[model samples]
Target chain A: LAKTTQPISMDSYEGQEVNITCSHNNIATNDYITWYQQFPSQGPRFIIQGYKTKVTNEVASLFIPADRKSSTLSLPRVSLSDTAVYYCLVAHGAGGFKTIFGAGTRLFVKA
Target chain B: DVKVTQSSRYLVKRTGEKVFLECVQDMDHENMFWYRQDPGLGLRLIYFSYDVKMKEKGDIPEGYSVSREKKERFSLILESASTNQTSMYLCASILAGEDSNEQYFGPGTRLTVT
Candidate 1:
């Protein structure tokens, strides 16, 4: 498993775009970068995933450079409800594999 | 939306008592996992099951055991619950073959052992 490092916390305002970056210096070739969003007392929810380049979804966008060593999760037009902890994980497959979550970036969206 | 239901949302138990946390999935997902979340430890895998009768020990499986008797159910058992064992437990399920698909998680169970 590749080790991941991300910001401990971030602050953003409503209607502003927020980007959280994760660095996996030793990322594996077979690993896929996945981002999850979690609110207080609730389980983490899947946001977006990408191997390289850009992958966009309704909730977020994932940007992975060619090196695959780092990735960024972009949330468009943030709101107060978007205030939550975001986790960046590197997982291989869906065969009951284990995923390691970092301390996660705590995004506090302000009004 | 895939539904992974945990048996309890909150539980309070005493030390030395047996603890059982149940999880069931309605999507027929072949993989089920147990994880514990703490303040700074993030999410640590306790155990995972690939099939009905097969299980694999994860990074932190020493103080816990798991059982999967049916395809849709997985149970985490603490033989003698301890104070350190108190944490938020989360259950997750994913399809068997999707390599890049995301996992569906159930509302976590918060266990407090005193």
Candidate 2:
């Protein structure tokens, strides 16, 4: 499993876009970048995933450069409800492989 | 939607008591995992099962055990509950075949050992 690095916390205002970046310099070819959002007292939910380039979903967009060393999770027009810890993980697949969640980026969305 | 259901949302147990945590998934997924979350530690894997009756220890499996008798159900057992073992436990399941992008998580169970 590849280790990921992210900021401990970030502050964003409502209606503003927020981007959280994760770095995994030694990402393997088979690995994919996945982001999860976790609210207080709730299990982490899947936000977006990408293998390369860009992948967009209803909630967020993932941008992975060609180097695959790092990726960014972009949340457009954020709201106060989006205040939560965002986690980035690198995995080959979600089988029996254990996911290592680092100290996630805590996003505080203020109105 | 894939739903992973844990038997309990909250539990309280005394020291040295036997505790059982049950997890069931309705999507017929081949993989199920158990993790415990604590402050400053994030989430730590306790155990995982890839197939029926097959189990694997995860990052922090000491003082814990798991049983997978069927494909849809996975159980985490604590032979002797300790106060240090108090934490929030989460259960998750993922599809077995290709394109297993994300794992679905269940509403966690907060266990309190006294």
Chain A: TM-score in each model: 0.96, 0.96
Candidate that scores best on TM-score: 1
Candidate 1: tens digits of C-alpha lDDT, residues B1-114: 679999999999999999999999999989899999999767888998989999999889988999999999999999999999999999998887786658889999999999
Model 2 residue-pair collision total? 0
Give the alpha carbon lDDT tens digit for every residue of A1-111 in model 2: 788999989999999999999999978888888899999988899888888999998899999999999999999999999999998988875352777777789999998
Segments of candidate 2 deviating more than 4 angstroms: A94-96
Candidate 2 docking band: medium
Show the colliding residue pairs in model 2: none
Against the true structure, what is each candidate's TM-score? 0.97, 0.96
lDDT value, residue A61 of candidate 2 = 93
lDDT of each: 0.91, 0.90
Q: What are the per-residue Cα lDDT tens digits for candidate 2 across B16-99? A: 999999999999989899999988777888998889999889889999999999999999999999999999999998887656
Candidate 1 wrong stretches, greater than 4 Å: none
Each candidate's number of clashing pairs is: 0, 0
